[model samples]
Target: MTYKGDVTVGGPADVHELTDLMISKVAVGPMDNNAYLLRCRATGEQLLIDAANDAATLLTLIGDDGIGAVLTTHRHGDHWQALAEVVAATGARTYAGREDAEGIPVATDAALDDGDTVRVGQVELTARHLVGHTPGSIALVYDDPHGHPHVFTGDCLFPGGVGNTFDDATAFARLIDDVETKIFGALPDETWVYPGHGKDTTLGAERPHLAEWRARGW
Candidate 1:
């Protein structure tokens, strides 16, 4: 099936196949958190992003091919509810933004900073640290070898607007600034956005409403 990028808890995952990598996106937990399982076609090396919930489901998705790393996009509890369970089961190394790493209960094997490279077999993902949604909210950027850029934006950039800053103007400002500079400014319009929750969107779909999102003060 074609990759629609829409998924529901308990529903089947959507798989997007690229030239050298495959992304399997599943929605899990009550919060409907999205977990992405990426596999490199060349070597079968796998990286699981956000073991949000349902270790059984995630582990089933893993099957016999064990995972190498589990990258939590942020420090949010909902996003890592199954982190310990999954890590314990697979012994996969844990990764998180450096500042948010201390907040997670599990020990981070890697404390990533902005522009860090995360590898899954032959594929490489660039970590773009966008602040304010949390002290450390990193979005992984995969410059697809065959197509446009694909970004795994945690809770930072969503379909309609940016992530919640809890009404703190300072935090909101920081988040918006980082998003604008690192995401909207740096990436192209066709960039595919895989957010932490809800459905997917593209940069072009949300670019014209930047000022509106700012004025609404979300």
Candidate 2:
């Protein structure tokens, strides 16, 4: 498969091949959340990003390889519905953004800060904390050496606009600012974005609309 990042709940996953890592994207739950299983090519170690929902499907995806960590993008209930069960089954360490750790029901083994590094075997993902979607929402950035950078942005970002802010101007501002500075400004246009819900997009594809997203204050 081409790894288009298009998936439907209960459908088979779309796998992306890279030199050192393999990305398996599967959509789960009623909300249609996307859960990614990142497997390190060398060590065969894997790390699951967002155990969003459907433990049975997620477990079956894990197979016997297992995972080292389950990092929640935010404290939102829909994003971590299967965390407890997935963690229990794999005995994987639980990680969440430092500020959102208290909000998550599972005991967080590691409370990540802005630039914390989470490893999946030899592969590493840098945590970028983008506020607004939730006080402690974090996006995982994977800079594949052989390829372009990839970001697992939770609800903070999407294809057309940023996540819903409930019309809160302050949160909207913070989110947009962080997104521009931490995401858009810092990352190149080619950075591939894998969001929490819906289809995927690239920073390049979304850069032109930053002003519009800010102007609308969404």
Q: What TM-score, over all chains together, does every model reach?
A: 0.99, 0.99
RMSD of each: 0.7, 0.7
After superposition, which runs of candidate 2 have C-alpha atoms over 4 Å from their true positions? none
User: Each candidate's lDDT (Cα)?
Assistant: 0.95, 0.93
TM-score of 2: 0.99
- Per-residue lDDT for 1-218 in model 2, tens only? 57799999999999989899999899998899999999999999998889999999999998898988899999999999999999999999998999999999999999999999999999999999999989999999999898899999999999999998888899999999999999998899999999999899999999999999888888
Off by over 4 Å in 1: none
Backbone clashes counted, model 1: 0
Q: Residue 93 deviation, candidate 1, in Å?
A: 0.8
Each prediction's total of clashing residue pairs, residues at least 3 apart in sequence or on different chains, is 0, 0
Highest lDDT: which candidate?
Answer: 1
Write the residue-wise lDDT of candidate 1 on 130-186 in tens digits.
999999999999999789999999999999999999989999999999999999999
